[model samples]
Target: MENEKHHIVPYRVYAIVLLVLVVLTFLSIAITDIELGSYTVVGALLLASIKSSLVLTYFMHLKFDQPYIRIMVGFVLAVFIAVVIVTFFDYSFR
Candidate 1:
C-alpha cells in the first residue's frame, strides 16, 4: 500500500477556530433577542452551519484529509441542506 501524506495543522489554527466558534455561539444567542420573524430562524441555522463546518474541518480533520473525504463530506452537507429546504417548503405550503 502506498504511504499517505499527512498534513499536520498548527495548534494556533485550532485555537483560532475554537475562538471563532465561541464567538459565533454568542452571536447566535444574542440574535435571539431581536425579532426578525422568519429571518431569525434562518440566522440561527446559518450560524449553526458555520459552527458545524468548523467542527468538521478542524475537529474532524477533514481539512487535512484526502480530497475524496472532503468531497464526500461536501456531498452529505449538500443533501442535508436540500432536505431541510424541502421540509421547510412543505411546512410553509400547509
Candidate 2:
C-alpha cells in the first residue's frame, strides 16, 4: 500500500496541472477579441508549450526517465522551432 501511495502522488499532481492547462486554453480562446496586439499570439503559444511540456513530462512518463529520450525530444523541438522561424522569415521577406 505504501508503494502505491508513492506512485499516486505524481499522478494527482499531473491531473491538477492538466486541469489548469485546460482552463487556460479555454480562457485564451475566449479572450481572442480583446486585441492585446502582438503579445496575444505569443502568450497563447507560450501557454500551449507549457501545457504540452506538462503532458509530455508527466502523463507520458518522461519525468522520471532516460536522458537520451530527453535529448531526442529536445532536438525534435528545436528542429520544429527552427522550421517555424524559417517559415516566418520567408513569409515576412516575401
Candidate 3:
C-alpha cells in the first residue's frame, strides 16, 4: 500500500486567521450598540459565518481536502439550516 501525504498548515496563515478572528470578535461587540435595525443581526451572522468558515477551512483543514468531505459538510450545514428555519416558523406561528 502506498502512503498518502497530507498538506501541512503554515504558521503565518494560522496567525493571520487568529488575528482576523480577534478583530471579528471585537467588531461584533462594538457593532451591537450601533442600532442598525435588521442589518445588525445580518452583519453579525455574516461575520459569524466568516469566522466559522475560517475555522472549518483552516483549523479543520477542510481547505486542502477531498470533495466527499465538502459534500458531507454541506449536507450537515443544510440540515442545520433547515432545522433553524423550521424552528423559526414554529415560533413565529405562536
Top model by lDDT, which number?
Answer: 1
Model 2: what TM-score? Answer: 0.78
- The clash number for model 1 is 0
Superpose all Cα atoms of candidate 1 onto the true structure and report the RMSD in Å to 1 decimal: 1.5
For candidate 1, give the lDDT: 0.93
lDDT of each: 0.93, 0.78, 0.87
Instruction: Output the number of the TM-score-best candidate.
Output: 1
TM-score of 1: 0.90
Which ranking of candidates, highest lDDT first? Answer: 1, 3, 2
Clashing pairs in 3: none
lDDT of 1 at 22: 96
Which stretches in model 2 have alpha-carbon errors above 4 Å? 1-10
**Candidate 3: how many backbone clashes?**
0
Worst 10 residues of 2 by lDDT: 1-10
lDDT of 3: 0.87
Report residue 3 deviation for candidate 3 (angstroms): 2.7
How close to the true structure is residue 87 of candidate 1, measured as C-alpha lDDT? 95
